[model samples]
Target: MDPKTLLQNFINGLSLGSLYALIAIGYTMVYGILRLINFAHGDIFMMAVYFALFFVTLAQLPWYLAAILAVACAALLGFTVDRIAYKPIRNAPRISALITAIGVSFFLESLAVVVFSGIPRSFRTIFPQSLNEMIIIGGEMEVKYGREVIVGGIRFPVISLITLIVAAIALVFLWWFIFKTKVGMAMRAVSLDIQTTSLMGVNVDRVIGMTFALGSALAGIGGILWAIRYPQVWPYMGFIPGMKAFVAAVFGGIGSVPGAVLGGLILGITEVMMVGIMPGAAGYRDAFAFFILIIVLSIKPSGLLGRPEIVKV
Candidate 1:
């Protein structure tokens, strides 16, 4: 491959990887706190994209406003799902909760089909036409010019810049909340021992709800960004990304925030590189990701950054 082509592919990989990381963080955060798989999360992310699309088409709203509304709708939907489906089974057996999650996932998908219909919807270009122009970089490589710059000939996409900025801001706030704030302390305490935290006068139910909301909101942002990049929307659009994000969470160690981000970037870049290196590899892209998942699990079941769980009998 030419140096310019290689540089462009790497930039694409980073942009794709960042989106995966954002969605994966949602999975990791929910699992970290509640140990629930949240099968409905992918659909929730999908719904956010649809929500933004609806606003853009029907209300004729600008991209920024549509995105904000989509995030709000996603957070609300996630909160409602927790209240209606998961909350009642909080104290039930683990199997029961898992079953409930599956049911909820199916219900959400079904509702989407009924409401949005099974047909695919394409999104209008969110960015202005002027922003779509290409610029020559390093006097040889051509890169898209927009609101962001390719750093020192690195050829990073403008969208990647936005994703990194949003992810960084979210991570910094989350770190502060988890380590510095009173609610953060309460959340950690509940994660450690819900019963004990309740006994200590913490509102366990509220904390769990907030956790779900926060995670879902992140997924919402990821979903809208995804729509912007791909510009396609369908009822089942979330399936692959959702599963991959879950794998990323597992690969990085389920409960670790940094781990999820790292895992996402690794998975995204590896998949992109596999296609670039092998001409026929694109056909097996989905399988390749799963194969990597299996290998990772076999070598390190707790995940690359996961802490080993200790059991006492």
Candidate 2:
């Protein structure tokens, strides 16, 4: 491939990886605290975009306002899902919670189909048309993607730049929240030992709910950015991407935030580069993630950044 195409594909890979990192971070956070896989997470990602669709299309709200509402709705949905589905069984066998997560996933997907229908919805009106314009490096001049753009160090799609910047900002906020704030400390305490933390008078259930909310909010950002990049939404659209994000989380280390980001970048870059190199195998691109998962599990089950669990007798 030519230098320009290679550069463009690398940038696309980073954009795609950024989305995966955003979503995968949610998976890691929840698992860090609850040890529950929360299979409905991808469905939650789907629901968030649908929420945006209604707010933007039906409510006729501005895109920025709609995005805010969508993220808030997603956080609310995350809290509600825990209370309604996962909370009651919080102390149940791990397998029961696992099955319930799967059930919840199915429920959300069906509800979306019934409410939003199976047809795909386009969001051409939502994203600013300027996002399609390219920003050439070494200068502030911008031009449309197909134009004779030059005088460059690198060319970046505005949407890709936005996605990368947003993901970085959101993740940084999350890190600060997890480390610096009292509530974040409470979250970490709970992750360490729920019973001990509760013994100290912390509201355990509330913290768990908040953890879910935080993770889901990140997924909301991811979903919105995803809709921006893909510009279309459907009931079951999140399954593959969600699963890919999950693989990213696992491949990086399910309980490690940085691991998820690393795994996502590696996976995304590899997938895009592979497609660029051999267009024929594009059909099997999805298989790459699972293959990595299998390799990781067989070779290093604890993952790159993960610590092996220790059971107390």
Every candidate's lDDT: 0.81, 0.87
Show model 2 residue runs off by greater than 4 Å.
132-154, 310-313
Which candidate has the highest lDDT of all?
Answer: 2
Tell me model 2's lDDT, rounded to 2 decimals.
0.87
lDDT of 1 by residue, 16-53 (tens): 77778888887777777777888888989999988988
Quote each prediction's TM-score.
0.90, 0.93
Residue-by-residue lDDT tens digits, candidate 2, 103-208: 9999999999999899998965466655444545456644455312344565566677778888989989989999999999999899889999999999999999
Task: Give the poorly placed runs of model 1, Cα more than 4 Å off.
Answer: 1-4, 136-156, 310-313
